[model samples]
Target: MMNEQLLDSKFETEIFNSQIEMKSLFYNLETEIQSNISNLSDFAFESHTDLKQLIISTNVTLQDNLKALQTDIMQQLQQVTDQNLITQAIITDFKSDILNNLSAIATYMNNNQLSMKNNFSFTNSQITNLNTTMQTNFNQVIADVQNTNMNIKNNFTQTNQKIDTVNAQINAVVTNNQFQTQIDLLKQQIQNISVSVSISQSMTSDQYRCLMIAAWYGSYTARDNYFNSEQYLIYLTDSGCPLLKWW
Candidate 1:
């Protein structure tokens, strides 16, 4: 149950992060468009240009800006799309593995359901082995996700730095406020998510699962008190999923 919840949580996280990346990219594009609008409006107002010439120049500027913005947006969008594809593939694979694990666990449980149900014949050594294997796989998945996130973050950092350099070059000519605040806020949000993800990874283990069960079923009030428990996540089950459970 805990594993299923974790899987669902991870899947949701991937989707959310992908959307966040898309939002950041769109925000950048929006800022660029606003800047262009301001520039063209100012040109129309301040210059003693012929109306025909002004219209032509403004139209050309808009076209060029749109094309450039499209290119930039497409590149960012592709990166995010690719990342999402990879994340989805990973999730699919993990779901299969987890399902197999659950099926095996369920079968074992059902076979011993009547007599010594909880005491089902599995040895401590076998349980330990399964735990070790699960832990190793979990660690590897976390590492892969972390690496992917870091790579994206590094790309974002590099792109932002380049943008800042370009903005500096055109600061005097551009009327916009450089849109630095939005960029900073977006970056901070990503960082916060990264930290939370790392904390989540660190808290997950066999011992933690045991703790989750203890807290989940120990008290009447605590039975559904999944709010503070790490295992209280969205997961899949043999019966049906995505299920939310405290353990």
Candidate 2:
């Protein structure tokens, strides 16, 4: 801005100086012409040829000086015009570059904002999904624990029933007098236990307890019936009624 103002001042000064030079040159020419015209009358007695040559030469010199001044003024104006064109072009390019930079910055900011919003939404969704999955897993664990407790309670009940059945058999053996009646009752109870074990093919802690109690009591009870005891043992082994289930 400062440089432009300085240039404009200089251009105006140059134009004003050129106008003054033109006015000065015209005043000098007019004064010289008036002096020659006054001298022409005095030299009227002299030859006409000298007077004609003087007038022609003065006119030619004036025209040449005017042409030279006009050319110099035009050259100065051309220089100022060229400087203005260069300044305008530079300003235009600067404005274009600044506008492009501003547009890029705005676009970058908008893209970053959108990306941040998307990232936040994705993070929130992940957190929600994680919470939902954790809740589901917690519920499954609770259900499994409940099922385990129910199974344990049922097994405990079955074991107690087996104990009661063993006590009843022991009482019957001690109270009854007939040897065949005691043998038959013992055989039936042993066969039932063997069948139950074979059908399961595996043993629970409660089932193992029942087997131990029955085996201990039956061993004592079957001492009087060696042949029948051997037969029951052979039947239990053949039926896969193993107390220890390695297979």
Question: Each candidate's TM vs. the true structure?
Answer: 0.37, 0.26
Model 1 agreement with the true structure over 153-216: per-residue lDDT tens digits: 8767766775665556444323322222322333343343333334343333543343333223
Which segments of candidate 2 are over 4 A away from where they belong? 1-48, 114-247
After aligning candidate 1 to the native by TM-score, how far in Å is the CA of 172 from where it should be? 5.8
lDDT of 2 by residue, 64-160 (tens): 6556655655665565566556555655655565566557557755777676576877645654665676566556556655655565566556556
Superposition TM-score, candidate 2 onto the true structure: 0.26
Q: Per-residue error at 170 for model 1, in Å? A: 2.0
**lDDT (Cα atoms) of all candidates against the true structure:** 0.52, 0.52
